[model samples]
Target: MLRIKKLDIFVLKSFLLLFAGTFFICLFIFMMQFLWRYVDELVGKGLEINVLAQFFFYSGLTLIPLSLPLAILLAALMTFGNFGERYELLSMKAAGIPLLRIIRPVVLFCVFLGGMSFFFQNIIGPRAQKQLWTLLVSMKQKSPEVDIPEGVFYSDIDGYNIYVKHKDRKTGLLKDILIYNFSDGFENAHIIWAAEGKLELTADKQHLFLHLYNGEQFENLKSQSVISRNVPYRRETFKEKHTLIQFSSEFNMVDGSFLDRRSDIKNMHEISVAIDSLTTHADSVGRSMYSDIMSTTYRGAVLTPADSVKIKTENIAVINTDSIYNSMTSQEKLKVLTTTENRVKSLSTDWDMKSFLTKDTDNSIRSHRSDWHKKITLSLACIIFFFIGAPLGAIIRKGGLGMPVVISVLIFVIYYIIDSGATRVAKSGEMNIVLGTWMSTIVLAPLGAFFTYKSNKDSVVFNLDVYAAFFRKLLGIRQSRHMFKKEVIIHTPEYAKDIEILDEISKDCQTYLETHRLKGMPNYIQIFTNNKHDDAIAEISKKMEALIEELSNTKDAVLLNLMNNYPFLSVKAHKSLFDNRWLNLLFGIIVPAGLLLYLNIWRYRLRLEKDLRVIIKTNQSIIEQIEKQQLYLQK
Candidate 1:
């Protein structure tokens, strides 16, 4: 039995609203990019409104799969971000509903969205891709609308360059026109100058009609010339001349059947079939190439006794070809060398062609295989992106379009870069097709899982202070303690106890420094192998901190300032790099990396020694100040 709660409906409604809007936004953006790539082909073509509409429609359909993952990512981020921002997520968690339970409905919806993405890619995308390509080709072939500008040569026509000095738009009359007709050959060209001409397109839009009022035509009869430098020309002066120029302005679509050979215009089943067929063809060609090379190039030689001498065991004795070459005449040697060189060259060229053929077939197979995995990977990417975006939104606790949009774009860009690079390498046969096609998924899935786990457990995944502290520990950076005089002293600090603690801390620091040889460099091997804790330094640090805490309540500003000067000590700064002995040994075994790490450890050791010296010095100053005040009170 299934029950739909108000929570599920609420979550679904929020996500669906955002998803619908983001899907269209992503689709429009991708379509704009797609159109920009072929803007040159579409502009000036004078395509009809319905044709342009169909182009956009098919383009959107084809880009639906690409847009789905980004749309889901943005929508999930915004949905969860809004929830967390509005305190709805907090209220739900407080009401005993975990983050996972809240997001379960959205997850299921994302799964459904993934299915829809796969459907669009497999069923609708192929037809849209084919139609879009066909329309683009048709647009490219269609002639530009005829509007001859003044004073510029219009070479958009196939074989004619027409220059108009001035033209009347209302009456469509040109004042001065110069035309170069190279339709016959460049050498046999015709140049025409017209005083006034009117250009019109035929009803079928296939040819240009040029009616000149007064013009002279010059024809170079180079083809009729018999000798060089004796070219003849004919000049004709006419009052009225009508010239028909061949220009096809009508839009004719290319046959899309040829596009079927493309891997993108195929379904999974078709791609699988293509892969099998290409693999089989490639294998057969390789086998045939091997057989041809063996049978034709390496055909066994049948020899008589004169060609080679036979031994007692009926095996021919080996002969030195250099000795045989030395015995030959010069012309015979040259002839034999020429023949061998030609044969070797012929064999090399034939093998190269065969190798290229085999490589082409293998590339095709890889392409088909990559596309086959692409369909499934894109679908899975939708779900992966949702998981990532939703959990990240919850962790970041950012709502509205600003932060969510930026994060979503960043994540999607990373995914797109990985997928594109991997797909290219896979197509080039440099990597396994499956791994390359699914590389983005593999890289991001664990990240999504980690975010989900962190968000579910209400962990601090993005807290800057936690990471700052970690980096401080890693770099052995010691922060100065900030102590100030309290306005109201809960318990007055006893100067006698503070002086005693300082004395003990100073003594421990001196003893540790003397025994541990703080001034010298640490032994590299001992640094890694030894896991001993510096209990002496730790005890000194513990007492110093406790004394500072007690004296922080004192009304004396000088004591507060002196307490602040005591440096904060890190207990494990000079300890073994790792707690695990095996890891330490392994790091030691790696020479280059271990050397660098050992140097870093030695630097930390030096810092630790310096901090201990500073502590001892600061403790002596504070002790002297406390004893001076006590002696003043007695006086």
Candidate 2:
């Protein structure tokens, strides 16, 4: 038992739901077309309902192998797309899960589907197709009701018009039947009229028989213009049956041995027989060539002796001396040589004829061998189609009607084109069958593998990044920058100016307090003072008024502007300024006290020195002293 993870189970469930929907949608659409095909046949040939139903059923079964792969591809793509969109894929990757591991279940599912397809193709598919074809044949045989729409001219079994006044559904009978038999040659035609008719199914369910009563038959004979025959009482019947309809041989044949006989077996037997014939012919040609060569050689030897005898007889005639002592003349000797040469030439011609016959036999044997190889190659296409479909679906990753249909059609088209071309070449004796039929599979398998690899990598080859990169290269756009070196700078002269003004005001107030404290109270101070320091109080009040007037009169518009701008700059500048260790320590302790006390007296001294440098056009040593003092405090 396989223990599936919760996530894997969820993924599988989602995929299956999608897959089932796609499969059924595809199946229904295909089945509709299948039904339409038979419907046309039924209408044209007047077929039966039972046969039509069986035709659709078997047609549905035959199409399952084609639809399964499409469903699988669609389901997988949707499943993976959902995972990717939800960031589940990212999560899984972060958790150290490999993509291959995630898709293992999908691959396993596809394998199971492939197995089912194989079962259907090898066993169920063929049987279903055979049954469907049988049913169609039977329907043709059983000439059922010709469903003619009212008021429309519908053709009868014999390709003639049939008109019905009315039809009784309960009785399955028509009140009137008028048939024009155009089946006969156009010049000689016949018209059939029946008062009433009923459609009947044959006892064996192999044919539909039409029974008519009270009818007249009219015919136009070529020699005799027109003829009409009428009867007081008449009975006519029409029968239509499919000739190819037959029971399986096993049912008819009593012998169990004959049950195995089939067309496929006969085809195989024919091929084997052809091969054997070719072999026998080759062997016969070889033996014939050997015998012919031997005969020619022996004939050549006999011809030489015959020519010599003739030559000797001629030479004796040419000689005029006594028979015992006479010698052949030069002309007689030359004539003897010429006769021998002609005999040798005749033997060589016979040998050449034998050689030509042997070459022709060898060529015939090679041709037959090529044909045998081609037949065997074509027979193995079923398995090749399986490989092509399964892997291709896995790679495409789209299993629904839309993508699957387009892809299946395109892939099959290519496969068919290649296979057809190869077959043509092979048949024409241009190439061998092994190369032709298997070539398509060999080419497409790698393409499927490439797609599968891309799919597994979660790579969308047509994505924005890919397109951008392509165009970027085409336009030659290339530049690089160091992002880390760029820093945001903040300037804060406003805060320092505000601190200088605050220091001046604090110093003047401290000087007034010290001067008042040094003076003793006058004698009448008790009378005016709420406590007994009346004189001191009056003097302090006068001095405080003077100080307030001076402070108010002092134009600190620049300091006010500085104060207003400091808040805005402080937030921005704090991080950058405090990033330095010394600045962080100094400001962290002093800034809070300085803000509370308004104690910018030391800061004002530094500011006065800066103002002196600007106004007097002279370097100020006080600014240096302030910086040195602040530095010493830090040390």
Candidate 3:
């Protein structure tokens, strides 16, 4: 039994759900298209429904290795996205968990999955596929006796024309059966005629037994009179009646020849040899040459003049400069150069350098020329996706089905496109196989790690300052200009005028309240006055609270408030007071926050839709939001 830790389980469940969902979604879409195109032909050819179903089922099995990595990648992204959105990653990191530690289980799981995929690709998958196709072909070519219609000739089955007057469903009997045998030439063909026949299914259902009574077998022997044998037979049995189909035997095992033809083996051999030489005492010149060859081979297929010539010339120059004849005259140096050139030329010619280079290149090219490599490449993609998804999830922090899905899809699409293009180039011998296969992972891994690192550190990648700057740029708007002087200028008369208006309202309200306190005033007047004051206070409080909330939420409360209050200030004033430059610089910090929010929403929706779909399909009661959360947590 496999024991999964709590955290591992969490990661696995998340990854599995994501992987299964993505795989099935794609599989369903593609399978539907495939089935739609072939279903009619299959049915028209009188194929058994069971066999057709098995064919599709096996087809999905064949596709598993191809889809597994994609599933892993998508699942990793979704799982990590959800974690980031939920702040689980942040919480873990805050608890002193390393990013590598957090991802350890996921990486291990992917390796395990990759191994399983290899087993399927090399073992079970091919066999199942071969069997399915064999059955399908057999079914298509098989003849039906009872199902044959009257008058209309049915020739879907190869080399046979079958016609029957009527069929009895219960007895599985046909009234009149006519089978035109075309196995031999039509000129010398025979006809099978039966007055009444019954078809019985064999135990395995692979063969059918036809029992005929009172039938005549007519034979047309070329250059002889037509021979008709009338028999009053009680029962005549036909053996091996079911269609005999043949399937390719090669699909049973991995082709040894295919593996031997791969260039990767050669590369591996060279690498192994280099490692061995490096470990033990070896000639420095030979070692250097091998090392250079390995590097060139690893980088790509072709090596131009720029690759080896520069290093060779530099080495020769250094050797000559350090020679014992260095103190000799310029003429002596010329003699040494001539001698060195001749030696090098002789060495090159004797070693057949061109052929060696060509051989190495060919070996490198052959290494990746198998379909098996595709499976391996896809399997390894799991790691790439995990890195990308985990960090992205943390940054986005909004893990529902909306933006997270969109972002995940976009990222995966980019990775897939690059990977696929690289694979093609590699197959064409334009690039090295290992480099091409791992290219997408190399490019995206760092990006994922960076995001995860920042997220773990509680750093935002995008902020409101960026939004403000963006808006300003888009609207072609500059900071407001305060045209007034800095010094406060107050006029006594204007201040007095404002004070007079305030005093008048205050006095009137006080006098009215005092008068009402003594007299039994109208109920309507008292109610109206109380309502107006309450409403005014409530409105003021609401406005203040809203502003306070907005400011609290902002990255820079003081600067944001200032910008809101003073719209006519110069750009310089805004920059000075609010440190707008820093704000602009910190704008990227909010990107992670926004992305987190977006992913959270996206994942939530996807989860909800998935749950709802499941419920609908199972005819279960609608699940509440809290219940759904519990279910997700439990899984």
In order of appearance, the predictions have TM-scores of 0.92, 0.43, 0.41
In candidate 3, stretches whose alpha carbon ends up further than 4 angstroms from where it belongs are 1-158, 192-196, 200-219, 224-376, 399-439, 446-450, 453-635
Candidate lDDT scores, in order, read 0.87, 0.51, 0.55
Q: How close is candidate 3 to the true structure, as a TM-score?
A: 0.41
| Per-prediction backbone clash count | 0, 14, 41
Better of 2 and 3 by TM-score: 2
Scored by lDDT, model 2 comes in at 0.51
Mind giving the per-residue lDDT tens digits that candidate 3 earns over 1-635? 65667877777677777777887876676567667765655554444456667778877776776566656655666677778777787787788887677777778877888778777765666566565555555554444432556666757445667688888767667877887767677865557777787655565545445666667666665553345454222323453233332212111222334433333323333444544443343345456667765765444333356855875767744434465677878998899789768866765674587557555554443333434355555666666666666666666666666776687678767887887888777666778767777677678777867776775575766677878977875443556422222243342123233234333433433443344332322232222122122232233234433432332332332323332322221112111112344443343246665344334334433333332233232211111322343466589
Residue pair clashes in candidate 1: none
Which consecutive 10 residues in model 3 have the weakest lDDT in total?
A: 568-577
For 106-175, candidate 1 gives per-residue lDDT tens digits of 8888899899989999989987888988888888888899989998999998888999999998999998
CA lDDT of 477 in candidate 1? 65
| Worst 10-residue lDDT window, candidate 2 | 566-575
By TM-score, the best candidate is 1
Cα-based RMSD of the predictions, in order? 3.1, 28.3, 24.0
| Tens digits of lDDT, candidate 2, 591-634 | 56534222232333233333222312211222233345447658
Candidates, ranked, lDDT: 1, 3, 2
